[model samples]
Target: MHQCAKEEKVRVIACGAIAREIIAICKANRLGHIDLQCLPAIWHAYPEKITPGVENAIAEARAEGIERIFVGYADCGTGGLLDALCAREGVQRIEGPHCYSFFAGNAAFAENDDDVTSFFLTDFLARQFAAFVIEPLGLDRHPQLKPMYFGNYRKLVYLSQLEDENLKRKAKEAADYLGLEYEYRFTGYGDLTSALTRL
Candidate 1:
């Protein structure tokens, strides 16, 4: 974690999953008064660690005398632990169940039945598929785990935030590897734009 510059008025502790997109949003809107500190994107695979990691970040920010803070995560996989932390700290987080939900627009994503069968990915996951999915899950060595882990998933939906052809191709490859149908949607940061801009 990085220290917030004293000039910064607000600190947004974020998941590294959306770190790049947050930087893009802040840059595009000239939100230079905000400081971003991120936990490892790899933590997305470990929901249990999220709450404590965020709690530490909040303490660090408070130590630096920054009172205006926002958490750039959804409920994520923390059950309600992250929300409880935010409430106790008196801070607000991006409203959504997860990055995929916010990237697709919360209500619209909820209304879609395809989500029940769709495994989701964003640009970050597409780029780090092997590091995050394959090796960590042992899918690289135990290919059989694929069926056991993904048995219920029917499709891999890539909610893209950019028009990068390379990332799209990588996402398609991941879908093929998992034996899931591939669908691409150009979401372009969805609700994240509005949320960060409000900072």
Candidate 2:
């Protein structure tokens, strides 16, 4: 962020679960006058209204006299937030892809290998999900659960965390029978970056 600020002469505004980590980095580097926009985890569960969330965040950023706002994370819940915010606030948003990919692609320290990138990304996501569940939600680490096999992929079967326990149990059974491996996998940002380069 400090490097970008020096080059672009603008402030960096970040959002998502990793915002605090970015803040720590900025503070450690003595980067001042940064406008950070922190949003709720609710958007992760429900990604539909993320446009409004971005709008609200942008409004807050503008109020802070930030000349430019750059979103470092743009995936999962915060994927569309930057676009919505750009449209609403009429500020140009830079093309920073998913968090991992962006970092991996822009990494100047080393010549990244494709295999190494893939391994790191996968591990990173797993660690991230594990941390979120364990630290925030207080969830227990049970056996590695597989997604229940449900044959009717054609049918519009909704699988939400809000579903009743009975329905969830049934879905799980179906997924397991179907051999669905829906376990969260850590994907390194470098993997995404390399994939994009291939394209």
TM-score of each: 0.96, 0.46
Q: Write the per-residue lDDT of candidate 1 for residues 79-164, one digit (tens) a residue.
A: 99999999999999999999999999998899998689999999999999999989989999999899999999999999999999
lDDT of each: 0.91, 0.42
Best by TM-score: 1
Question: How many clashing residue pairs appear in each of the predictions shown?
Answer: 0, 18
- Give the poorly placed runs of model 1, Cα more than 4 Å off: 1-8
Candidate with top lDDT is: 1
lDDT of 2 at 111: 48
Q: Model 2, 1-199: lDDT tens per residue? A: 2231333233444445445445555555545544455565435445665566666666766676666665444554455655766666666543444444344343431343422212121222232444432233333433333222123232212212222445444444433433443322222233323322221
Error of 1 at 145 (Å): 0.9
